[model samples]
Target: EGLEELSKHCFDYAVIDEVHHAQAPSYRKVLARLNASFVLGLTATPERTDGVDAVALFDDILAWQATIGDGINEGSLVPFHYVGLKDDVDFQQIPWRNGHFDIAVLEQRVENSARMAKLWMAWRMHFGSRTIVFCCSQRHALFTRNWLRDRGVKAAAVFAGTGSDPRGESLRALVSGKLDAICAVDLFNEGVDLPDVDRVVMLRPTESKIVFLQQLGRGLRAAENKSRLIIIDFIGTPAIRTSDHSSPLIARRRMQ
Candidate 1:
């Protein structure tokens, strides 16, 4: 409805975020109706789930481009030590729908005592001073926080519904060394910066390469006394279930 109304007025340029979604039916329909003279699409990753190149929708013209590796080599982003610990949860057990797993069932499985124990073991094995744990749900994040706290690890969980950093405390606690980790569900994915986050724990399975990369950016920001970020990823057996992409371990194994 908003797009339809906006389509009536022509603009010189239309800037779109996460521009990779332009190929989707809704975006396509909206773009078709718009009468902009020029369009600017911005995205960190332009790959799509349907196997189509998103650049094609933007006229295939040359523009500014900066790859993650480029940023790492230039020293603007911290180089990372990625550790892929084997997770016991079978990927096939979760219901797959529309290119992603069912979140409800996946959360239940990931929140299991044994599963959480494995996750904690990996964190303990490679302990980073400050870490951000990406979880499947708010409950999963809270459970992880309490589980870690019980083991004497200072941790907290923050999400959208509760708003503004879960516990009504500043996330700056991570920088002060008061908090060891922050378990979150989409709160720190984007638009928020945590420069002191030296580690990232990917506990959720994601099909979108863009989202995976965005979550990773949470820990890549350069900071004092921080030379590298530690990425502890839980890799399940048989398959990792991401859309048309190899397991993150396979791609990041050379970093170690």
Candidate 2:
């Protein structure tokens, strides 16, 4: 019924989230079905490995942006300390990219190991008061809760596996200052507001500009004048090269 009803409704205003994914046959078909006078796309990495594909969809690209490096160098955003991917991690074994997750490997690495556990401890020592850890999997989320509890830090994790009621409760606790840090896969991404998340520990890295912006946006919100959003890039390297194919499109927002 959900699919039937959705098919019948003629969308007047279409907002394509992570529009870069639109190139896929599924997303493209959905975009084609919609009949709208205005189409709004939101993506961090608009360019595919094949190259930019968004030019054909929109009459004009309303705006565009720079990477985390550019923002920091320009003083528009805060400087971040990029941490090593951990000594235990073997770069050759994992398939690293800018826009996806290694669910199986990442889950094990975050859970049954001291690497991430140790990093969490360090993250707590520096910014334990108000922090957010972006885990890469459900197992990671579960493991993080136990790991923090053992260390005597008031930490909690909220994810889809927590059931509807409990998930809501955990988020409430975090917002009300009941939890020191929160870890989850999809909960804290774009649009899920938690203004107090000053410390961002990125256990996952995506090439998508939208995902990075959304995850970073979580900590950027006003937070008692936090010493800027402290982002710990767990994954080494710049994830992807966004500048090579980018155009000259500009936004109207003031940086200062």
Error of 2 at 246 (Å): 12
Clashing pairs in 2: 44-209, 44-210, 45-209, 98-206, 98-207, 99-207
Q: Residue 82 in model 1: shift from native, Å?
A: 1.1
Query: What overall lDDT goes with each candidate model?
Result: 0.77, 0.61
TM-scores of the candidates in the order shown: 0.76, 0.66
What does the lDDT come to for candidate 2?
Answer: 0.61
Q: Each prediction's Cα RMSD?
A: 4.2, 6.7
Clashing pairs in 1: none
Task: Provide the lDDT at 129 for model 1.
Answer: 94
Off by over 4 Å in 2: 1-18, 24-30, 47-52, 63-86, 94-113, 162-165, 204-214, 222-224, 235-256
Supply the global lDDT for candidate 1. 0.77
TM-score of 1: 0.76
Please write out the lDDT profile of model 1 over residues 77-182, one tens digit for every residue.
Answer: 8878888766778878888877778878887878878767777777777768999999888778888888888999888888877532544474878878889988
